[model samples]
Target chain A: MIEFKDVNFSVDNKIILENIDLTITTNEFVAIIGPNGAGKSTLIKILLNLIPNYTGQVFIEGKLNSEWLKTERIGYLPQKEEYDTKFPATVMDIALMGIAANKGVFARFNKQDKLKAMETLDKVGIKQFNNAQIGSLSGGEWQRLMLARALLTGSRYLILDEPEASIDKSGVNSFFDLLSELHKQGKTIITISHDLHMLNKYCTFLVCLNKTLHCHTETEMLTADHIKNTFGEALKLIEKDY
Target chain B: MLSYAFLIHALLGALLSGISLAILSPFVTLKKIAYMGEALSHIAFAGIALALLLSLNLSLVTMLFVLAVAGLIGFVSRFFQTEETNVITIFLSVAMALGIILISAKKDYSFDLASYLFGNVLLINKTDIYSLIVLSVVNISFITLLFKELFYMTYNMTVAEVFGIRVKTVYYLFLFLLAINIVVAVKIAGVILVTAQLVLPASIAFQYVRKLKPAIIISILVALVASLIGFYISWQFNLPTGAVIVLVEFMLYLLSLIINKRSKVRN
Candidate 1:
């Protein structure tokens, strides 16, 4: 559904991302893993068009990168939802923000929209917290709420950055279940996760970056080699502990 | 309550400021830009000081000059967003320093430190009412029209950009709304103490509401209550109206903090 060919980007003449080429197929779950400051997040930002003035060719569904706006085809969930946490809003209210996105300032949401929002929240397992203030939700519940917010767009593609970061071990299992359910619904899931063990279960494709680009399929990608190469000496310490 | 003309003026100004501050407060608190917004008010105070020194319409001059300086601060800070605290500190220092300089230079600058510190509701006049009406209409319409873009930008700016939202335009627009709210509030609450009205309501609203509309609506209601109590307390005690209003807001904030603690213990 998306294509990036030879993307090169520099901030203030310092190379941030370089020579990146990859294609994200429809209904595929791909994770790009890397160490801190490894350009993994940069790739996501570039794809989302957060970082402008980049050198590359990005096409979404055969359209030029510059031509597309944030349509209902894609939904984004950021790493940290610190803003909404401190604010007093209910789960239903945030999910409804996706619907409000399409409406004008004066336009009111219809009954159908509210019902759909509730349904989305239910799917994420936060339906019980539908009326509960989002700040009052636990970490796991909040992540699910974020998913519901994304699903409110009814988008086929979900771009989640560090979706499981906030959740704990028990929460991660539930989050995995949530992802599995979303996957079953024939949605395209492109997530950037640090969890390496998920390559066999959820991730069908993989990309690794450390100020450069590397792409491999599940069959060809080796875990230890790629991690060591991308992370440098840090991976050695991790391997020693493991 | 007795005089028709005076009452109308008071109501218009209060409602206009109440709504404007309601919408602007979330942005200030959520983005952690309260410090910057607070400093801009002080900068606005400096402009008012200068206008009074020249015997000009303090309101008009304050609006134009603060907006200009605020825009400059906005532009400069975008390039230096490595640390939010840095931007906050830089703007706060500049604004505070300039305000002190201007105030100290003029021996008879009659911009009462008390009213500006807390806000003088009793000083509400016809001219202030007219300005509030214009500001309220403008702020409400602007926020309504750009709600989606602003929502996206404030929550996840990168996502907003990817979706082709004019982030720079929206960013500057946010600054403008903030500047206007500061001006609207400065007259009623006074410059230094307006932070109570601007941030406390939203922070309290945020603690209870998970949705934007309810949060905003509740914040306005909260502000209205605080404003009324403030006016009443000052009248009863024969004290500065602004300080009373600020104190009312302080109590609300304290109440919220206690509630937060109780909830955390329960969780």
Candidate 2:
């Protein structure tokens, strides 16, 4: 469990996020949603204890963040993590990063590690592209690859930003399903995104943010007040049938 | 040919610089801040100028002064300034001006500016060798102690910060490591040509591999080979060692490009 109390962050003298309070309970899928430039990304960052210079106190498991060592407990996937895709690396090789987190750098991957990596990739439907150059994959394909990586880590807490942003409808659905399965398995997920439709099924909690934050339960329903407070405009349910 | 002692030292210097920087460059290139090399190189030049103006030993002043200036610039650029390039450019210009002023005021300038501009294996001495060993040790140790921080920062700075990795501390450490490498390299490829060590090896490795470790390994191999062969050619043809090393690096880059193109065609 992680908590941020009265957190504020500024970049280049421009106020990004201010007076923020967030808490992630056990096995909670908190989807932080806000319009573009609404400081959603900064909120996740603060929860992780990344920006200590910012004015606030962050406690991990009720201890000062400085006292807590970051374990392989939190798995992360960035919004646009680029790879040499042209660089000759296999899907298995990428997944091994999870293994590296557990085993020291010098430890060789054994049979079980390889099998787990393969199983994860297969679940994401890119098992056949195991040896394929990451660069050769399409946008949607790469997203799945990243998902497979996060899943393989078996991290208790998964932090993903906009996993469905570039993926096609089918890929988005499958990814959402994967998240659903992961949640059922008791993984805690913290994600930041603006795609309400894709997140509606899996997300149990929501933090509508725009420089400030308002936390609400999913079934509580997003009100007109919540929409204006978060997005400063109407919620556009633009459908891609996605 | 065997009696040429300084030539061996120069070649060894290049080899070490190439190999070490190659291993280190992946982290630098990943963050797209490879310009740390250029920034530190100018700062080294400023050290040389400071030595000249103070009438101190050229090598000692250049080494110590550059290290200080590099640290100063690194500290300022990472903490105070938002745009690194803009800060580096400002420091670089200041260093160039200092170098010019010091050179103009001095009456007896030892050695042609070319050897200092490029590299001169013919001039390497024991002091240079000693400095390279010490500086390389510092660079490698710093990297070893902070490999996790470096990897995390490279992949994602903001996330790394949240994970309790001191992003600013890592930034300063990297800048210092890069600065040390530049200072040690003055005896091999000179200040202006230091960019090749920082950029060339890593970029070439990037062409061949994807993983952070392999790219770094391949880069060191490529750089070491280029440095040794370049020195050999320079010795055999009685040519400038600096230019030869750079030429060899360029050729490797070109060869890698060709190889990549061919592989693309086949795929």
Among the numbered candidates, top lDDT falls to: 2
Worst 10 residues of 2 chain B by lDDT: B158-167
Candidate 1, residues B108-227, lDDT tens digits: the string is 665666666566665689777777777767877776777666665666565444434455577777887778778767877677777767788888886665567677777878878876
DockQ of all candidates, in order? 0.30, 0.25
Tens-digit lDDT track for model 2 on A59-109? 777876656545534577778775444444566766665555565432467
Candidate 1, residues A108-173, lDDT tens digits: the string is: 668988889888887788788888866688878888887887777667878888887767777776
lDDT of 2 by residue, B1-267 (tens): 755565567677777777667767788788877677777777777677677667888767876877776666658877885675787788888987888788777778764666666766666677767766776676667666666566656765654443334565777767766766776676568778877777888888877876777787788788878888887898789887777888898899989899988998999
TM-score for candidate 2, residues paired by index? 0.81
Candidate 1 CAPRI level: acceptable
lDDT of each: 0.72, 0.73
- Which candidate number would show the highest TM-score if scored against the true structure? 2
Number of backbone-clashing residue pairs for each candidate, in the order shown: 15, 5
Worst 10 residues of 1 chain A by lDDT: A233-242
